[model samples]
Target: MNLAERLRRALDAPAPEDLLAGDLIEGASVTDGIVPAAVLVAITRRAEPGVLLTVRREHLRTHAGQVAFPGGRIDPEDQHAAAAALREAEEEIGLPASAVTLWGSADPYRTVTGYEVTPVLGAVDPDLPLSPHEAEVADWFEAPLAFLLDPANQRAIEAEFRGRMRTYYQIDWEGRRIWGATAAMLVNLSRRLNAWS
Candidate 1:
């Protein structure tokens, strides 16, 4: 039906107790000595469905100029991964804490850049304005959730990393590249929704 509908349906469907059982950490599979990060898969509450992605500024020291979902590391005082995600998002994008509704946490993802990131899924009202801090979001846009969940639209690209040949999933949308772990997670979500579809 729409973005909100897709998320609602996904959330409403009967899920195993383990699905909502606990917070996930990405350290298990990620390389040793890597810093762990908590990332969020923030969705929009608008009609015709889409997702919010951030384009980091080119001058940053870390992950400089990367396209990422809005989130950062877990705070010491934060209760869980979702809390860290919402807190980081609000701090970076100025999205009011009350505006978000968390769905559930996805599988922990291991990044090539030595980050063990846990992705949290949630939805928010589409009209709320965003103001990013720390990272300069060159732009933000909505891409249909259905488009991302589609397998035919997904593929991988071979690249060299640290002198080793690596494969990364590339999701090209309107010329934006949603690759690596983000693309894989989107693929996972797409498969989940596709079953329901």
Candidate 2:
């Protein structure tokens, strides 16, 4: 099957009941004033598929200099999460919405930061020339999908945040550390894909 078809099937599959779709820390909650956000998990359609990610500008106040997917809080005007993801991708990475083929959305992942993020999966041409927005994105790169989805590469780490011990998944690609909500969402995607397979 083609990449789009495969992605569609994977997304359509029901996530297992035990699958960790959100923050794993105890007492973490998204019930109070939860901000709805969406991210574009852009997969490159090529001989070796990859996932696109970005490093936020260090000067920014929130999540500065951290690796992240191209996205942000869903605006009130956005029709839905998918639209928001597409718009954010365009704004952050200069990736035109027209260039992406939407596969579907994955299960929503809640972060400790109080953002309930919906991940929109899409396929794009591997050779597309993407320009990063200077104010928000510092740099962008693609990591191989195989390496990212591998359970062996997803490492669990415990750290103190807000005076509480929390466990989160981390993936190291080259010198970049992909972790926290971003890595958790990738783990969710991996579970969905593996379930389909």
Candidate 3:
């Protein structure tokens, strides 16, 4: 089967188990105040498929300088998760909503930062004109989809957060670090794709 067919089957499959930041939280509850967010997980249609990612601007109040998918809070005007994801992707990375051919959305994942993020998976032409919004995105790059889907690339790392040890998954592509909710979502996607394969 082709890449699009594979992704379509995976997305059409049963909802996967939720992977939450709560797994890393040591003591206190982590799901008190939840905000709705969505991300565009765009797979570049190229000789070797690649996943689009962005390095958030350092000056941003939240998740500054972190590697993230093009996404943000679901606005009141947005109709659904995929709509919000597409809007955010356009606003942040100059990726036109028309350029994305969405396969489907995955099971939502919660982040330690209090956002319940729905990951919208799609495919886009790699040659599409893309320019990062200077204020929101420091830079953008594409990581190979094969590299990201490999279970061996996922690593669990622990760190002290708010005086408690927290564990999270991280995947390093070259020197770019993908972790937190983004990494968790990718892990979930990997499982779905692997199962369908």
lDDT per residue for candidate 3 within 81-157, as digits (tens), equals 99999999999999999999988898788777788899999989986789999899999999998898788999989
Candidate 2, position 104, lDDT: 85
User: How many residue pairs clash (N, CA or C atoms closer than 3 angstroms) in each of the candidate models, in the order given?
Assistant: 2, 0, 0
Better of 2 and 3 by lDDT: 2
RMSD of each: 4.8, 1.5, 1.7
Off by over 4 Å in 1: 1-30, 195-197
Report how far residue 20 has shifted in candidate 1, in Å: 20
Ten contiguous residues with the weakest lDDT in model 3: 15-24
Q: How accurate is candidate 2 locally (lDDT)?
A: 0.88
Instruction: Write one digit per residue (lDDT tens) for candidate 2, span 1-197.
Output: 75445656888887866567677467755578888999999999887789999999999977788899999999999999999999999999999999999988899988777789999999999978999998999999999988898889999898988777888999999999999999998888877777888
List candidate 3 stretches off by more than 4 Å.
16-24
Find the 10 residues in a row with the least total lDDT in model 1. 18-27
